[model samples]
Target: MYKIENLSFKYEKDKYALKDINMDFSKGDIIGVIGENGCGKSTLFMNMTGILKPNSGEIRYNDEKIKYGKKDLYNLRKKVGIVFQDPEKQIFYSKVYDDIAFTMRNIGMNEEDIKKRVEKALEAVNGSEFIDKPVQFLSYGQKKRVAIASVIAMQNETVLLDEPTSGLDPRSTDAVVDIIKNMKKNGTKVVISSHDMDLIYEICDYVYVMNKGEIIKAGNPDDVFMDEKMIKNAGLKTPWIIKIYNELKNNELKNGETKEETNLKTIKTKFAQYK
Candidate 1:
């Protein structure tokens, strides 16, 4: 489990990036963190992964407190893998296979073991066919998959993804979403930071809505999306289905129906009834 208690950060002494943030994430949870730009969503992830230290707070993995020492930080980083928003920033080695094997090699894994693990990771992301291809030759989506493969090769217990679907076509978005679902099935704690409402509704089991460096609300997807005012206040819009449902509720435009009878399928059926 990952736990943050009273976490806070300030880029300058007078300006705060994150304020009194606290939350807990457990295995088998796909959490979506959303907010407007500069709400400190990325800052929070950076702190948890030890890329940035909090001005005052505690970040704990399991029950042990994390220390800032180089050795301890290295261990923590190995356990928590982060996929940046831009895939290009994470790719470095000449070939796809070498990039995926880079992290394992850095940690001093044996040659034979590294090869075996690299193959498995590639297979996980459906990239085994391109093992020898130069990363620069691969398309944007393929490079993203290779980036993910690199992290999976590390075998981390927790994965933090920053905008995994930022600049991809619909097909690539679906591919990345499939990988995230697979991670949850395997009991890895996956936390995603995204602005895509449809993606959140489709995959996230829980969500934390942030605004101005604070988490304003958190709950199941349906619960959080139902609050239109709270959602808009945080610089987000409700999903289309929820927005339609809300409008129907407010206008009393029921075809001999009540609010209690409305649900995802029911809403779809109602909208279809008009067509």
Candidate 2:
């Protein structure tokens, strides 16, 4: 539900962190932004969330231009939430509940409403079991969930996650993915920037391949990942599903369309046919 046009940002003079970026985020779509570090993924998120205004260009949400007035900015932020790459950067409170409750409190939400929102947010991330636990006592994955809970608590319409699964283990990554899916099911649009090609293929419906602050390719995962040259240009590899699908289509298994299966077990079973 957000549209970015000619969006450019610069942290310092003569150094544009983002340049001429254009993208449309549709409702109910899980969009992935993938590129090498310093390619301006995080900078794009900051601009989208209004943490930093674009040097040029514009951002529109729900067909209206984003305004920088105090009330308008607050409303925009309430509509769009962000979780940073490092949980430590976002999680300040020692306790899980308080950390999730921090944003609501700053907005002057009443205690009763804060408690309900905090409880639901933690429960959504499956972190309710340790809601009162100290943040320092939590594992890396738990901390990640807490970070997500903090954003979810804000009930923002669109959530931007920068490297959400960066340091998470397999189980924790799965947990985070589940939380994202639940968010989609509950009608919260998600835009995530990640280096995890497999996760991007698995969850994201629309993918943008960025290189040097510009989007080189944008399409469904199958279409985007199948472009080996562009994938390499973006400093990423084709997902194994696309790789195998290409191999099978080019050799022996002719006259059939490429399979877009991302699951390992299904891929193996499909490969058995060629064997």
Candidate 3:
């Protein structure tokens, strides 16, 4: 639903934050952006959400070029919501409910609809039980949930999450992932950046590997991860699933079994049988 062409951005005169970035995001696709720190994942999201305008090139959503004009920018933001990497940076209200309701209120949504949406958004992030809790009292993971709730309450067609699973325990990471799945189920296209290789491999339909402000590789998870050199150069590791699959292939070959290429599902099933 969104297309970016030759996008370039420079924070300083001599340093470019993004360079000739091009991406086409379609409905129902969970796109993953993976790279080390300062690789411009957040910069790309900022430009996509109109928080930062590219110095050159264009972004088109549903065939219309995105402009910074008042109405156009407002409409673009309404369609695309971004959740920053740090929850503390985004959660301004003291209460969880109020923080989530902040956006709806600004848009002049009535109390009745706002209440329903607030509850629904919190529920989507599995934060309903702590709906009225003080933001300061919530855990870092809880604050992250609240941050996601704020975006969900906006009902944007696209959600951009920067390192959604960072700084959380396994349960919290799983919870954040569930939120991504729910967003996809609700037909909200999601573009997420994470250092978690396994999480990206598990949920993302397509992946973009970024290095030094440019995408080095972009493809389905298997194809992108297959390039070990590029993956390493981008400061990422191969997914555990791929590692195990390769091990299984080696074992089968050593045992004189037929060496067949296996997909994740087949490898999982075979591993279960082996166990």
Compute the lDDT of residue 273 as modeled in candidate 1: 88
lDDT of 2 by residue, 5-100 (tens): 999888889988888999998823799999998999999998887788898999999999988888998999898999999999988988888888
| TM agreement with the true structure for every prediction | 0.92, 0.90, 0.94
lDDT of each: 0.87, 0.88, 0.89
Model 3 regions lying over 4 Å from their true place: 259-265, 270-275
In terms of lDDT, model 3 sits at: 0.89
lDDT of 1 by residue, 131-224 (tens): 9999889999898888988888898888999999988999999889999999888777899999998888778988998999998998888889
Write model 3 residue lDDT over 1-275, tens digit each, in one string.
Answer: 78999999999998989999998887237999999999999999888888899999999998899889888898888888989999999999899888899888988899999999999999898889978899999999999999999999999998999999999999999899999999999899999999999999889999988999998898999888878889889999999878987787777778866756555679767756874
Ranking by lDDT: 3, 2, 1
* Position 226, candidate 3: lDDT: 74
Candidate 3 structure, TM-score to reference = 0.94
Residue 23 of model 1, lDDT score? 84
What's the residue-level lDDT of 256 in candidate 2? 45
Cα lDDT of candidate 1 equals 0.87
Each candidate's number of clashing pairs is 0, 0, 0
